[model samples]
Every structure is written in C-alpha cells, then in structure tokens.
Target chain A: MARTDPDISPAPPATERGRRTRRKLLDAATIEFGERGFHEASIASITRRAGVALGSFYTYFGSKEAIFRDLVRDLSEGVRQAAAQSLAERELDALETERAALAAFLAFAREHKEIYRIIDESEFVDPESYRLHYEKTAERILGRLRAGAAAGQLRGDLDEAHAWAIMGMNVFLGLRYAVWSKGEEDRPEHAAQAAATILSEGIGPSDA
Target chain B: MARTDPDISPAPPATERGRRTRRKLLDAATIEFGERGFHEASIASITRRAGVALGSFYTYFGSKEAIFRDLVRDLSEGVRQAAAQSLAERELDALETERAALAAFLAFAREHKEIYRIIDESEFVDPESYRLHYEKTAERILGRLRAGAAAGQLRGDLDEAHAWAIMGMNVFLGLRYAVWSKGEEDRPEHAAQAAATILSEGIGPSDA
Candidate 1:
C-alpha cells in the first residue's frame, strides 16, 4: 500500500480494499480541506469524515501535507481525464477540439465545485503542486496547439504564449460561467461558443 | 486615520504624516505576509518590519486580517492603476489599448512579483476580496470592450464572457511571462503583442 514517489507523494494502494479506503479518505479530505481550508483542516477530522480509524490513516498518507499534495495531483489528473475522455469521443477540427476540451472542463467544474477551492488553496498549502498543475496543463495545451499548427488547422505562428492565453481564457470562463454564475443563460455550451468564436475570429470588427 | 467605509477597508488618513505611517505599515505588511504567508505572519512582525512599535499597529489596521484584506485591495488598485496610467498616455484603437494594458500589467507584475502571491492567497484568506478583485477587474475590462463595440472598433456582440476571456488571457500570460519566467525571451512587450494578435485576429489560419 505504500510506494514512495520522489515527484509528488507516496504511491497508490496495492489492493482493491486498500484503494477503496484511500479513495474514501481522499473524498473526505476534499470536503475537509475545501470547507475548513488547509490551516484549519485536521487529520482526525478527515479520518472521522471518512469513517476510517485514525490509526489506519497512516496506511495511505504519511502526513496531512502528503494527503493534500496527493489530492491536488488527483484533481489535476481529473481535469486532464475530463478533457481526454471528451476528446476521445470524436475527431474534431482544431478549433472544435479546443471548444470540446473547454466544454468538458466546464462540465467537470460544475460537478465538482470544490475543485476551484481546493486547487486555489494549493497555491499556499502546496506551492510546488500548484505550479506543477498549471505548468503541466499549459504544456498539454501547447502540444495541442503545435499539432493544430502542424496540421494547418491553426495559425502557423501559434506558440507557448498562445497556449497560455487559451488556457487563461478557459480558466476564467469556467470561473465565471461554471463556478460563479447560477443563471440559465450562462451554460457551458454558451461559454464554449463564446470562446470558440474568439478563437475562430477575434473580437475586432470584421471591417477592421 | 480611520474612516469607516461599508466597502473593503478603512479610509485614508486625514493628515499627511498619518498617511505616511499607514503606507509604511502596508509596505512592511507586504513583505511580512509575502515572506511568511498569512497564518505564520504576525502583527508584531509587520510592525517590526515597518520599524514602528507594536502598539502603533492599531493606528491603521484593526487586526491582521483587516490589514491583509486592505493589502489585497491595495494590490488590486495597484494593478488597475498600472494599466490606467499606461492607457492614459495613448489614444490607440481597441486592440492597441488592450495591448498597452497587458504590457503595463506585465511590467507591474515583474516589479511587484508578490502581487500574484498576495492576490492568489486572498482566495482562501479573504474570499470576498478575492472575488471582488476579479469581479471589479472583469467589470473594468467589460467596460472597455463595450466602449470598443460602441465605437465600432470591436465586435458589437461582445459581452461579459469576452471580457473574462481577455482577463484570463492577460492573467496567465502575466503569471507565466512576468512572475514565473526570469528568461530574456519572455518580455512584456512580446506578451502584449501575442495577446493583441489574438484580439485582432485569432488563432485560426489566415487563409481561412
């Protein structure tokens, strides 16, 4: 159940039951950390919330910081899988691919509203994970942009800055339309379309 | 020195000397909070950094949290002023205005690298100020977008989502190019141009 990884945290559980226990702990930790924050959140509270014994907590995570770091990595992977699963369903054009990826992200954000809170909190609780999350995410976007550019679907000059720009656009759009707004007018589809339009055609007047 | 306002924090000092003291405390608090973070940071440390007595701390801030909130507001205003000052000297078109705003932001961010750390930490420490900061910043961008639309310089259908999109682009770009990268390749002017190009003409192929 304990495999040490130099990168982020300890390795995954070896058995199914162990995995289930770890998952429960993580789910509980998500709520604890999300609601109370890193400073106020406690290991005992997390164990109590998970319906697991305090002694068993050490089986998966070495410390509170370990669990928090793992949780951020888990969430980061969740974001990646959300988009990956969505992208696998169809062969989209470059612009459509970007739109689909964002749509998936928005849907994911709505389902797991704690995502923003937990991820934002990581900036303080685990600065390395926080930076790693964005750096990796930006790298993924850059890869897509490069592919699009090579395929002649996107502008030839697309670079890392462009990827960062697109990433920023998707993040804020999710923050507004997904996390903040409760109105029916602010659907993920609508947000996706607005973003897609920006990608396909800039906001400048056509005559310009 | 304190004027009670229903908004973010206490009002400005009536006397220049009092104003200077408050400014000193805020400046010192920036270093204290930036270095130690919110939880570990103390009022005594901030006062010590200010070269002022601990008893004089209350002359400006009612509590550590009050000063933290004020600091977030102050940094938010600083960001606004950075862009505002840049924009004031120019009579550029819509795209050029955005370019200037982003360039100014990038430059400001480079000088005050702690702006990112402080503003981001506010999400957990002071959620209201965090939300208000982005909301207000987005509103400002939206106003500019609307003005561009009205002047027929930008798309007439541009809305809040568009503003958020542009805001996100600028934020991440600043985070990457200004706060993170210490390399010569990541210049503010270059970032500004990349974003402006997206605003003028998106990532879509030119022939398309």
Candidate 2:
C-alpha cells in the first residue's frame, strides 16, 4: 500500500521557492537526524542548518517526526531515480540492468554516507517509515524481475523472496563498499560486476 | 580487532553456579534489551526478570551498556552455532551448505523474532558491536566460500564481496520471511530454497 497515511505525511509545498526551501530542509534534516538521531535532533537545528526561518519549518513539516518520515521517503525516491537514470543511459539486458542499478546505488551511497544510519535508525524512531522504505524498494525490484521474466530473460518463477534477496544483496554491498569503504580501491564498478556475475551465473563453478 | 576491548568485555564466571547466574542474566538481558532497548532497559529489571538478585548484575556485567554489548556477541555466537549445527548434521556441497546455513538462520530468527530489533539497535547503542557483528559474520561466510572454492565446488574467484552478498541475502530474507512472516506459509525451507537457487543457478532463464 502507498504511504498515504496523512498523519505522518507532509503536504507538498506549492511554489518553486517553497519546494526549494523544503528540499533544503530535507537535506538539513538528513544531516540532523543522521548525526544526532531522532531524540537528539530538533526542528530548530534543522531550520538553522537549512538557513530557513524557524517559523517556516511548520509551513512544510508538521513536526520533527513528520520530517524524518518524509526524509526516508525522499531518500527512497533518490534511490529510485539513481537506478532510473543509470538504466536510461543505455540499452542493456536484465542482468546488466541489475548491475547498472547497483552501480548507481553504490555511487549514491558513497556520496550520501549518512543514509544507512538514518534509515536504520528509522526502525526505532519511525517504524512505519522504516518498513515502508524496504517494502517499497523490494516491490520496485520485484517489478523489475517480473519485467525481465516477461521478456524471457529472468527465470519465470521469480517471486517476492527473490526480490528481497536481491535488495538485501545490494544494501549490504553498499554498506561494505560504499559506506565503510577504505578508499578508491573499493570500486563500485567492481562490486556491481561481482553481483552481476551472481545473477548472470551463479557462484558455482563454471562447469558445475 | 577481536572485540577483546576490555571496556566492553564481560568477565567470565569462576564456577558452574556462577556461570549459570551469568547465563540467566544474559538471557534476561536479551528480553530486556530486545523489548525496552539499551536506554530504557535497566539492570534491576533484567535481574528481576532473571530472578537473580540486583547485586548479582555487577557480578556478570559492569553496566547496562556492557550487558548490551555482551548480548550482541551472544546473539552473534548463537547465529554461528546455528549454522555450525546445521552443517554438522550432514555432508553437503557448497550450494547445499549455503542453503542449509540460511535455513538454520531462518529458523533461529523465527524463534528469536526480537533478534533483528536487538541487533539493529546495536548500531545506534553500540556502534562497535554492530560493525563487528557484521564483519565477523561476513568473515565466517567468506571462510565457507573459500572452503567451497578449494573443494572445487565453487568458482575460484569468489571473494569477500560474494560472502557479503550472500550474508545480505540471508539477512534480508530472514527479515521478510521470518521476522515479518505472516504465518506458516512463509516457510524457512522455501526461503532457503529461493536463496539456494540464486547461488546454484542465477535467476536468469534456465537456458540463458
């Protein structure tokens, strides 16, 4: 189900300026919650970070919890767009699509290192958003799998479990190579290729 | 970084009776930390739950944070034991070993549904424990992959990324199918089979 729960949902800002301010607040909130966590973070700090007026905070978000929920959704959307942008750059088969999407995700995660902390904290701060984030991501992956199956690329029997497994793999790979990366040696492309190999050919020996 | 960091490490009990008391406190700590989390969880509550005297807490753990760290390590050991127990039951090839390990993990997660929350919360409460848990688990998985490769059952090129990917797949599958499971229909064996399929044969079409 879509996250139409109005109680936690922030109303969309109308004007172009309003949207930019909202985006700035979200970016600031990401850092706030990512570092300070839900309990330690405050609306005042987020507004200060965004350089927006304290009174203007309520114009968009109802409260701290509301913005945190919205932030998770925003991050989710960013993940979706990253994959979409990567897939649009060139034509590729289903396996390559997964590889490219993961590559994009790794690159995104590297830039936004706080993502894992903020998202993982949601499990406690806002359980609904936390669950929704993974559920929606898994759903998107399932959709892709189904499309691949329909195109006679992936296995016909791919199901929700398969989607979850793939999501798990991508998320963990990001955690290792992106979030906890040492340096340039932890290349996103190499990680993506490793995952692609698993999908294109299982880890079993080539002859096996 | 063997996690022998003296600050967080709990001392071993000197006698069998002392050991039992320590075990009782840890078991109670699991329920306490699992339910109330590290901050809300109190030593008195855990001691009361364990039916041990309040003074006995310090005999085992130094503080609430100490107990929480130990609890995470205990859970990590439990996971390791589950896989070890499963693998010990019979001889299997690389794919089968991975499948059986996941099956054991799913069963463990189902029985201890509080596991995901506890382990995840460790990320916020005890960052070192959280990172160590995953790192150690991934190392174990890599060990298995290496063993498989040496046995000629898996690709010789398998590395740390493959292990992390497999660990992620297992973790996410357990989250969806075990923790958030609807009912018996979400069988551990079924989820394990789905994961095993990915490792044995990629999700690509049979002929592809």
Interface RMSD of each: 0.8, 0.6
Q: What TM-score describes the B chain of model 2?
A: 0.95
Q: Write the per-residue lDDT of candidate 1 for residues B1-208, one digit (tens) a residue.
A: 5465333345668899989999999999888888888889999999999999998877777788899999999999999999999999969888888888899999998998888889988998898999999999999999999999899999998988899999999999999999898698777777788888888888988888
For A180-206, candidate 2 gives per-residue lDDT tens digits of 987878887778888999998889999
List candidate 1 stretches off by more than 4 Å: A1-10, B1-11
Query: Would you list the C-alpha lDDT of every candidate in the order shown?
Result: 0.90, 0.91
- The CAPRI category of model 1 is high
Q: DockQ of each model against the real complex?
A: 0.83, 0.85
Lowest lDDT 10-mer window, candidate 2 chain A?
Answer: A1-10
True contacts kept of each: 0.85, 0.82
Q: List the residue pairs that clash in candidate 1.
A: none
lDDT per residue as tens, model 2, B118-174? 999999989998999999999999999999999999999998889999999999999
Name the best candidate (by DockQ): 2
What does the lDDT read for residue A126 in candidate 2? 85
